[model samples]
Target: MLRLIAFAALGALVGGVIVIAVGPSTVGYTVAGIALPVFIIATVLTLIARSVGNAVGASPEAVQQAKDARRLGVARIDALRQTGTQINDQPLCELDLTVQPLQGSAFASTMRTIVPLTAIPMFQPGTERDVAILLDGGPEVAFIDEGELSPAERARLRVPGRGSVPFIPVEPHQRIVDGRRRGPLLGVGRAGRPGRIALFTVVAVAAAAIVVVPYHRAVGQSFAAMQDGRLRPDLRRPEALADAQRALEEAIGHDRVASITVAADFIIVEAPRSAGDTKTDRWTYRDGAVTHDGAATTQPESTAEQFSWTDVALDRVWTLMQDGAEQVDRPVGDALAYVVRATDDDVHSPAFGRPAGPPEIMFSVGDDYGTTSFVADADGSGLTAR
Candidate 1:
């Protein structure tokens, strides 16, 4: 039960540390997607650690040779030399060193080995010091008697061993001392089961997942989506189009619109006037945005000429009716009426019965039994009675 709690706590601590290390963008995904799975993994590892520790304890005589090797006299550091700035592509200082076994005269000559700078203790070189060197084969060298080091510091100075020349110098408590920092320790029997180390390794991998998955989603996928338009279309972009429409309405005024034309990134609205004319207002839109002109404008000084004449001019007539401009006995009827001459071209003229004047274009408010007929040109000119 305690093992399970330790595993859970370790998983939680790892998850929390990862959430903070990766910054705000990862906080949500880390908790939502990573924490539960990590807890499960840690629990399994803790159980395995305990089981393996017990198995090793049952077979103590199996590694009696390793126990004896550790009791060998310490090796002495003779000199230290900096090799280079990197090792196996890792950014760290490497060193060349010379040492000699103190009690065991195994080597006829002084021993030379290459070590990563992290393995050395915090002491000046050229002084005789107790350290450990692997007998089999290893590039690392470590101090043997560095006391009371923190976990991180101990990791750096830990010696390398294969078939067990003692993975690390034995703690006093592991022997015959009743110390406060007691077991459920990892990796060693009676102190900590080897499971603690494995549990931590699992936690590290889980924490990495929390940071990496969210970063790939938020940063990587977004950049990929930007390269292709088929990934999303204008219909999917409601916010952008809505904002552009608002800008258009504010530009032309809401009460003036007769018809609106929409495009992928632009909008055009036609507004009609009581004078039987139409004005065109246009606006452009960018994705994820809606920027309207600050000062709303019903009509600007200059506009497209082709949009206000001929068949398009009918929009203004429609706007006038929709706005109730024809209700109060206004000049809307006369403003739209026109007459045609038989001698002039009549193709463009309205079919207002028999032709009687030059061809003309005009707003058509209403046509009745011809009581008060009026005529004008396309420019609202040439008004006269037949």
Candidate 2:
């Protein structure tokens, strides 16, 4: 709940500030267009974190689903659970659902809505039949266990033309991933016309819109100044980072940003606020940081962007990513891995060099199988993983 509140608050603050600072502009083109969308995204993230956090404790419906799939019925095994010091990519009972292109966007008209399922009987890392599902109105294909499909198995589906069809969709088309496919997917009944799937999708979009639309409009307003170039990102300069920190502390009201440190490209604000093993993380950029002695903490007078540079760089990347977006792909239960290259003098490349000296290129990359936080440092580089 706190996480959700944080997200909503962040959106509200950012959006509200943008809206007020820039006044009102186009209703369509503003960040408000994606406010609800962004909040919708934040909500999804929070729910996912909560769900995975609560994976060990099975809900009644989930238990029943297991029972229904069992011999006597999906029997309730005492929610078998185990966690590790690390994260893994292998699904407990990895299931990949390959929806045809159209089935995926629902609104898009290219492919039939295929709801492939290699779904786990349980969400946690446990044991169940590794399956691949095909939802062509009904279960079009089901890969039993976690094995390759035999010729006979493939032939059973009466796949017309092309003769051979992949047992499962690979790469981009494989949509349903990890536990996000939890709860239930939009379903379809017999006739498939009054498609329950479509209905569910409509309801979902509407529900999401109710929240997303408002959030979208509100946010666009928040960043209106920046978008207009009037409120340029202050973080573009190293000194401006301090000013942003001062402003943030003032906003938190009395909350201290005393521990906040400024980096060339980023600001590390050591906000100590938690009683548990973990605490919340807040990321935002402004004009300045507040201090107790009625003055700005670090540099006296600096630029204004603060850490806002990240937003621009990310946006630029997103814009340029349009063309090749079709080529990139991931597994059903896998996630999109985005990396940030190193930039300081001590920073190294993400790849290895033949004969290294003071410089080493290493990637602090992560994927479904946890993280591969390794550096491509050579013998004489004098650099090590931190």
- Each prediction's Cα lDDT score? 0.37, 0.32
Best by lDDT: 1
lDDT of 1 by residue, 1-386 (tens): 44545444555555455344332334645453555565666676655443332111212232233234552223334344443334354323222233333333322112223344565564335443444433322112344454423345334332222233322222221221111123344334434545665675575556556544543322332343456633322311334334444554454444343333433333444454322344433333333222343322544222222222222232222233323334434433323222122232356745333333333433333345333333344333444433
Q: What residue runs in model 2 are displaced by over 4 Å at the alpha carbon?
A: 1-14, 19-386
lDDT score for residue 171 of model 1: 25
Provide the lDDT at 166 for model 1.
26
